[model samples]
Target chain A: MGEDFAFWLAYLTNGKHLAFYASFRFTILAAVFGALLALVFGLLGAMARNSRFAPLRWLGTIYIMMVRGIPDVLFFLFFPLAFEQSVEWALSLSVCSAEARAGSAWPPCPAANLFFSTTEYLILACVSLGIIFGAFTANVIHGAMRAVPRGQLEAGRAYGMSEFQVLTRIHVRQMWIYALPGLSNVWLLLIKATSLLSLLQINDIVWWAGQLGSPNFLPQAGLVHGDWRWAYYTVLFVFYIFVTLGSEQVFRRLTAWARRGMPLEA
Target chain B: MGLLEAIWTDIQLLAFPALFNIYFAASSLPIGFGLAVLLALGKNSRNPVVSRLSSAYIYAFRGSPLFIQFFMFYSIMLALNPIWWRPMGIAWFAMSPLFIGPLALVMNTTAYTAEIFYGALRTVPKGELEAARAFGMSRLQVFRTVTWPNMIRVAWPAYTNEVTFLFHATALVYFTLPVIGNQKDIMNKATELFERDFNVFLHFSVAGLYFLVITMAIFFVFGLVYARMMRHMPKERQPHRPRLRFGPKYIR
Candidate 1:
């Protein structure tokens, strides 16, 4: 029995399975970067919604509404193409020689034509995910900010703190307690959203799993496995469950810590 | 073709796929809702084994990507040969993506909607159930008359969102599964046009607009239902409670 286990382990850890590592690495990197970008977008969105100016508030509202109303997968497909083309178009005007630009109907210049490498696609995936999820985080943070007691802000003001001081000190600190649950939820979504990276043709884990599990009829590929996609997908299934459940536990602990010494008002 | 004519041709090509998208969503929601009620009941059962099993089922489905789930379901179904099994020796399992696509969507939606139902069940007022029992209602009667209606009422708002999200999810089917005999969803058709014409922005934009319009229609219909169903509640109670924010929880 132990020998059988060893054989399978050795097989999976071999050179052919090296692509799995790439998928795993990119998935984690995308999630981390996406989360950080989402934080920035969410903070800005919330502030804009709360702004005194009508146009700024309107911009934030429209951004959130459009994102929330649209299906995320559409954005997943649309953003990269739009972004890539826009970049290429800008480069065509500025970077391409006039001779190179003369023939093509669209851009008319090979110099302006940008073929996105896998790494660039991965970056775009992260940015797309960040932008899509940012709307959701903005909604959560806005609610959390509202949930912070008005009395607490007034108390800060009574203590002779300026508006900025009160916001930086009390509002931001207390908002975490309210926001942790929602933020954690977003984190899980962001992680799952990383799965869509494969759809962008980034060769992420899902793509690798599909390719590696496909039936290898050609004997020269060195592996003679039949279609084992189910097995590969099962591995991904368990990996995701473990990651999400682990995040859930961590968030629970964080929430508990945040709520410590506070009045139980929920 | 001129730009207007080209766009018109793309739209004509996408019409059938758009119909399939509606068919996929419409078929899954009710079936998933029924399965979800049973799963929710199982999760809320007194037996630890049943409850734990249901919880594990929910966790497994909710934790993984729906895209992966669709692929996994297709692979597993394709791998299984029902003809090899005796007694019920039918080849129904080996059917085309048309059949399997909805199966995947149903299973995934059931897991998500079950959690939503289970969460609502948790909040069913104990006093009402007690009152039903005190009035000589049987266990089934109490559940049917008091618990079920109240659970549905509480879950309606979230369920509306779930239905909309499930509609959005129909787009992923063709990406994961092989669309047999030109059977494709709107997204698939849009992708085909984009590849054929290299008009990335126009074709995809039209597809996106279709989805946005469908989602708005869903919201509008559900809003009417919400108004009628929730009319008896107090003004404060009628306001939709914000469930868990974003992510899997949003659908749940």
Candidate 2:
């Protein structure tokens, strides 16, 4: 047992483990940024769906409806490559045109030469997470907004508050209370979805686990590891279970906190 | 002419896989629903062991993400018998991708839908059950007449959503499963487009459109169900009560 402990401890301090820990940071950054982006998108979507303008409402409704139709994995795979190429293309045209005219720099600016580096790839991955999660969050928030009573808004208007004021004060604040459960589930799903980042070659923990456990690691060959990628994945499973379980407890507490002092209303 | 030929080929490629997907979604739904109901009944049974086992099954499946679940089953099945499936006691026909892929999908759906049914069963009206008992119906008869109808009606909307959700979620199988039906599955073909033409926008946009159409069809069917259910329901019971706050007490 002690030897096993020593083995793991030694492994934990290496560059792979550093990358693994960094993956958690990336996951956190993705989650926080994704949540913020989703919230913005959700708000815009919900408001537009509720709006009087036909085209705006249609656009928002279509976005949410279409997003709900497709599996999230496609979005994850599609967005990064597409976005990268689009960005690169735009940059190439602008940059190459300027550089071509100026005749400057060692590497001639060309369309084929333009490519997103690793950091840009990571950023694109997060943006993909944000886009996919934003659509889900939109559906959740849209439902929560609908869940809020029309009477609340009418009462606000009865008190001479404008539509904007009613929305800001009554709707936005109360939507959180109603939306918390669904949003929490979405957030948990987002956490699980982050594991798919390894497929993007983003140097996530799962990627490292795949690397460290593969038989190709000749240096670490004499260790007790075999085709234990599954074991490493099992560790991820446990980590996710813990993350979700812990977050659920927090969500329940938050719900209680949010519901306090409400007039015994449903 | 070239563009027309390409479009025709794309449609031909998509035709079989799309049909297979439709069949997959339709079949798994009933299987999942039946499994869920049985599990729910088990959970509600007087026997503690039965209840506990059902609880464990639900928790284990629900506790983990579906991707991992799919991978584990796919790998383990491949590992255990490279040539034969022990369960069927027959040669697995290792080359045939159809068997395990759909099986994995159905198993995952069953695990999820079972939970949903269990939840709906818990919310079955107590007063109606008591009323049915007053009518002197036997257990099985009461279940047939009173319980099942009401339960189905009450659970229809949710069950419909689950069907749609599972259909949407089937897109995940592409990473592991080989496409059947001339590689017709829309996402699989769309993915091929990504690799072949590298036209990310065009392929995904088409895939997105296919998904939209399928989702609409699902919604339309469910909407009809909703309408029919509403028509049969008592006029006074049409309005839905606001969902109760169950977090604080029940969560722990």
Candidate 3:
């Protein structure tokens, strides 16, 4: 039994398994940066939707409706590809001759073609994650903004706070209480979306799991193991469940903190 | 005129692909809905083991991403193929994405839908249940007359959202499952067209348009059902009957 335990330990700590462990960082990084971007985009979107300016409101409305209507996987795949093509299109205009531009192939010329490394792909994934969840966050924040009592804003005005001050201090500050639940929901979604980081060619945990779990056969040593993909994927399935559970606990505390000393009288 | 013609052609090409998506959702939803009702009742069951099992199942599925779920289940089914599926003489059907895709989707939508139904079950108006019991109705009769109606009414709006998201999730099927021959869904076909001409904007926009139009169609049909459900209520108190404007939570 002791020998068996040692063999299992050695097997798990092999180079590939260690790399699988390291690949988790990409998932965490995407979630963190993606969440921050989503918050920024959400605040802007909700504010625009609530804007006094007609065009801005229309822009926000269109943004929310359009993004929310489509499945996230589409945008997740589209944005990076679109961004690359747009850059290439601009590059072709500057570098390629007019005749070259008339060609049917992509990039117009070889010189204008761009390849993204893992870092760029990860960044693109983050941005796409932001755009998708940002719409969700905007909807949540917009509703929460309306849920804020008018009397609170009126009190800020009565106290001589400027319009911006009233918003930043009273309205937006208190909006957290209502928005926390929805934002947490978005966070759950955003983290789950981090699984798609591999689709952009970022070597994330999901990619590693698929690679490591496939059956291995060595020419010299013979069969290593049959397919263990189910085991690896089960680990991932549980990993996400834990992430969700952890986020819920943290959001619970955040909601409590947001509501602290605010008084039920409001 | 050129751009319009290209778009019209692309739309025509995508229409066939779009049916694959519609088939995935249409095939899975009825089974998902039925199982969801049972799972919801299981969660709400008086038996502790049943309740715990149902809760754990819901929590696990709900907490995880559907993308991973698809990959996980597909791989597991593959791993089981040699031992379990192939020997059973049904691997041809069991191993196909047509079978596995909706199977995974059923597992997923069941969780989300059951959660909604469970919430509705909880909010089924205790007074009404008691009133029904006091009238000497049996449990099954109480369920049919009082509990079931209240549950459907309370759950319908959320269920509509679940259905839309389920439809949206059909996009993920081809991503994880192996495509047979030319059978492709919206995203797959769009990617293929993009690879051909490199017109990322045109193809993707048309694809996105398909999803958006189908989502609205789902809402329109569900809203009609919702309106019918709430017909007994006073006109003004009917919550405006699911107006087409983006109220909230279109695609969860």
Sort the predicted structures by DockQ, highest score first: 3, 1, 2
TM-score for candidate 3, please give it: 0.97
Over 4 Å off, model 3? A264-266, B243-252
Which 10-residue window of candidate 2 chain A scores lowest in summed lDDT? A101-110
Q: Count the backbone clashes (under 3 Å) in each candidate.
A: 1, 3, 0
Q: After superposition, how far is residue A113 of candidate 3 from its true place, in Å?
A: 0.1
User: Which lDDT values do the candidates have, in the order given?
Assistant: 0.83, 0.69, 0.90
Q: DockQ scores for all the models shown?
A: 0.54, 0.25, 0.67
When 1 and 2 are scored with DockQ, the better candidate is: 1
lDDT of 1 by residue, A199-243 (tens): 887888898888888886665766667788889988898899999
Model 1 C-alpha lDDT per residue in residues B26-53, reported as the tens digit of each score: 8888899899999999999999999999
Residue-level lDDT tens digits of model 2 in B19-73: 7667667766777777888887787778999999987777666666666655555
**Candidate 1 displacement at residue B231 in angstroms:** 3.9
TM-score of 1: 0.92
Clashing pairs in 3: none
**Best-fitting candidate, measured by DockQ?**
3
| CA error at residue B201 for candidate 2, angstroms | 1.8
- Ordered from best to worst TM-score, the candidate numbers read 3, 1, 2
- Clash pairs for candidate 1: A104-A108
Query: Which parts of model 2 are misplaced by more than 4 Å?
Result: A1-18, A95-114, A143-166, A216-224, B1-8, B23-27, B46-49, B82-97, B131-138, B177-184, B222-252
